[model samples]
Structures are given as structure tokens and as C-alpha cells.
Target: MTMEDKREPKRRNPAKTQARILDAAFELFSSQGYARTGMREVAERADVATSLVVRYFGTKAALFEQALVRAIYERGFFVRSKPNFGERMAALVVGDEEARIPAMMVLAIADLESREIAQKITRDVVLKSLADWLGPPDAQNRALHMLTLMNGFTIQTRHLRTGDVPPESVRWLARSLQAIVDEENAPVN
Candidate 1:
């Protein structure tokens, strides 16, 4: 066959390509971090041309921000369903190591590198959404407490390597959080 006949067919769907790029970008940005990761690397990971990445995202910083946001929501940080929600959350926090560590690291970078207003706005919106999911009677407070616990767990275990805290400890933490939920739902005399 001639060289012209050997060329591969082009991708027909822009949306699918964009989604793939975003997913690849999120994974790389999370694992390698924003500062360390490059546009070429992101494009390479996405299996697209570097020009396509720039055409879609404009710049590496913009790509990082968008990727980080997608990663946050994709993790379902505020979309917990009831009836064993706590257990489900525990499974995500403990089981999803690939997503967890990178999220924490990228969040740290966002805090340090991005604007304060962006972080504050994201924090407020996420807390409100989570609180709403959690229900009333100091839902905001409960949500914040739960977030604090999760983020701290991420920082301590993944970053600090704080003593080999076993899987059972994580289970206990989930149970303790569930106790809070149960107490809140209990009827008063």
C-alpha cells in the first residue's frame, strides 16, 4: 500500500475527543501535579495533537483549572445518596487511591497558585451542596466536619504517611460519621 493509504481515519466526534482530553488531563494533573505536568504531556496522554489541547483549552493553566474542577465533581464529592451514604463515602475515600491522592495534591496547588476568590467560591458552593444532601439541623456544620475529616485523612495518610492507620480505622471513622447522621435523624421526645 502507498503512504497515502496508510493514514488513519480521523476522529469524527469533537465532544468525545474533548471528554477524553479532559479525562486524561485530570489524571495527569492529579498524579504529576499542575506545576510538573505539561501541555505536550497532557496531549500525549489524551492521544491527541498538542494543537488540539491548545485549541480546546488555550493554555496549560486554563487546562489545569478546568481539569481540576472536572476531577472534583467527577469524584462525586457532593452527590452522596442516602441509605449507607457514609459507607459509600468511606469506600470512595479509602478505596479510590488513584483519584484521592491526586485530588488532594491538586487542591493544594489550587490553593497556592489560584486566586483566593475562586477557592472561596468553590468552597462555599461545595459546602452548600453537601449540606443540602446531608439535610437540615446544622447540615452545613456537619458537612464541613465531614469534609475536614476526609481532607485530613487524605493529607495525613497519603502525604505525611502518618503511621500505617489500618483499614479498620477508616471503617471506624465511617461508623462514627454514620452515628452522627443517625443521631440527627432520631426523633425527639
Candidate 2:
């Protein structure tokens, strides 16, 4: 065999490493929250070094944004179901009433902060991407209606989860809103 036979294949996959960091970041971030979790903690949890986490993700905010993005990605809800925004928004309350903390964290992020983050959450998930699906709002009020309904459902369901699945509570809100949208979407008499 030639000396070139001695060469070993690459041991670490960049994709796998990046995924590990992201997974660890999400675990720590979701449990402890962005403000509480540190790069060191994520690196330790991922079994990588602290510098590696920082090198890959930069500051805490950058790492956190990535983690939040991961949470959204792992959900992969939009891709699988591909429902209308209002339907998808209603769906959250319909399924999985067991745990809501992480989503509550997402809501808390919007509630606690005042910056581009809030707008990004609103624009990226609650509005533009999904709105683009709906083919443009008829008016400003209509836009607000869709956005607020989605962005607050988790927070709204906080009380409902304490007892039963709260179908009546969730359906009341979902159907009431759906009624108006459905009515507006209906053919004129």
C-alpha cells in the first residue's frame, strides 16, 4: 500500500457538530432561558469546548436566536401540516396540552422585549411567511387579527392547560375568530 493509504477519513462531521451544539443550546435555553444559559453551559452539555460554542454561535443573543430557531425547526409543523395560519394557530391548542413552558418562553420573549426580535417573531412566523400563504390581508385590521391570534394562543391557553384540554375555552376563541375570517372569506350574499 502507498503512504497515501495511511490517511484517515475525517473524524468529526461539521454538520453533526453544529447540530450537537444547537441541540445542547436548545436544551439549556429552553429549560433555563436565554438570559440564564451561558456558552460554557451549552459547550459543556454538547461535549464541545467553550470556545467552540462561542466560535460557532458568537454572543449569547446570537446563540439564543439560533436555539429559538432550532426549537421552531424541530417542531417542523408548517412543513408537515401546511395548514392556514389560523388553522395552524388553532391547532396548537388542540394538540399537546400537557406542557407549554417552552412556548410560554417564546411568548415571554415577545412580552419582555421591545426590539426587532418581537417584530421578527411576528413577521417571520405569525405574519409575513404565513400571511404570504393567505395572499395578503384585505386591510390593516385584518392583519392585526391574524397576528395577535397566533402570537398569544400559548399565553392564552396557560390557564386552560391547568385543568382539562379546555376545548370550550380554546374553541370559543378559535371559532369566534375563525367565524369572522370565515365570514369575510365567504361569498357575498
Candidate 3:
């Protein structure tokens, strides 16, 4: 080939590469924490050379971000899939449609985890979307708080521990959050 032709590197399909890398990272990271997942593992899973992962994601940190983002969106956190916050939250509480939140939690607490990145994305992409479609700031906080409560609650529920939060408390929390939203949206004198 001519020097000009040699200089022109073959342009691989970006979307396909992104999906393959994400799929590989998701499998590895979901099973093993970020630190434990190596580029080789993802490459093997993706049926691509390890260098391709580096080319696509730059670093494992970046790869993890793509993996997590895809997992969240791919979990079916969309309105067409489920139209209500209760349904959405409930899915998360038990397990999302993808059953990856528990794995995500473990991954998030890993040394390489980036809660700042996670929260920002969660808020900007996940929470903000839900808020705009659902309600206001209070609704936003409510969703966040509920997520925390569910996290703890699910752990206890799994162990069948005593002093568990009653169903009524969950109901109260939901109603109170709604009240806060209503109060904020109320007309000022």
C-alpha cells in the first residue's frame, strides 16, 4: 500500500467496539471489583486484543465508567419499561431488572470506585431525568434517601434480622417525601 494509504488506519466501528468492551467489563466488574478486573480479562471476553480496550477506554477507570453507565441504562430504568417511581424504586429495592445494583454497590465501594462520578451521572442522567418526569428537588432528595433506606433495608431483609423497618415506616417515608415536594411547590403568600 502507498504511504498515504498506510497512514490511513482502518476505521473500526466505534459503536460495536464500545458495546463489546462494555459487555466484557460488565461481566468482569460485576463478578470482580474494578481493581481485580484486568484488561486481559475484558479482552478475552470481548474477543478483542487487550490493546483495543485501551484504545477505546484509555484506562480501566474510564472503562469502568462505561460499564457502569451501560449497566444502569441497560437495566431498563426507562419510562417505556416502567412508568412510575414506585415501580422503579421497588425494582431497585429488590433488584433492578438487570440484577446488577448489588454488584454495583460492591464495585462502588472498591478502592478504584468513583462515587463523585457515579453520583453526578446518577443525578444528571438518572435522578434528574426522574425528577423532571416525576417532580422537583424534594422528589430528587426523596428518591436518593429512599435508595439509601432500601440499601440498608435489603441487607437486613436478606439476613431476616430483627428490629426491621416496618412496612408502615416505608409508607410513611414515601408520604413524607411527597409532602415535602408538595410544600416546596406550594404557592407563597
Q: Pick the candidate with the highest TM-score.
A: 1
Q: Comparing candidate 1 with candidate 2, which one achieves the higher lDDT?
A: 1
A best-first ranking of the candidates according to their lDDT comes to 1, 3, 2
Pairs with backbone N, CA or C atoms under 3 Å apart (clashes), candidate 1: none
Give candidate 1's error at residue 151 in angstroms: 0.2
- Candidate 2 per-residue lDDT over residues 1-189, each given as its tens digit: 877898887697778888899888777765555567778889999999999888888887677666666666566544533334344557664555322323535543743442345456556654554444434235345656655655466555553346655666666666655653554465655
Q: What is the alpha-carbon lDDT of model 3 when measured against the actual structure?
A: 0.64
Best by lDDT: 1
lDDT of 2: 0.59
TM-score of 3: 0.65
lDDT of 3 at 53: 91
TM-score of each: 0.79, 0.66, 0.65
Q: Which digits, one per residue and each the tens of the lDDT, describe model 3 over residues 1-189? A: 778976867788889988988988888876666778899999999989999899989988788887887777776554542224444454455443344554554455656355555665676776666555445446676556655655565555433557655676556544544444344456656
Q: Write the per-residue lDDT of candidate 1 for residues 130-188, one digit (tens) a residue.
A: 77778877787887787767767666656667577688877876886676566568775
What is the Cα-based TM-score of model 2? Answer: 0.66
Better of 1 and 3 by TM-score: 1
State each model's CA lDDT, in order: 0.69, 0.59, 0.64
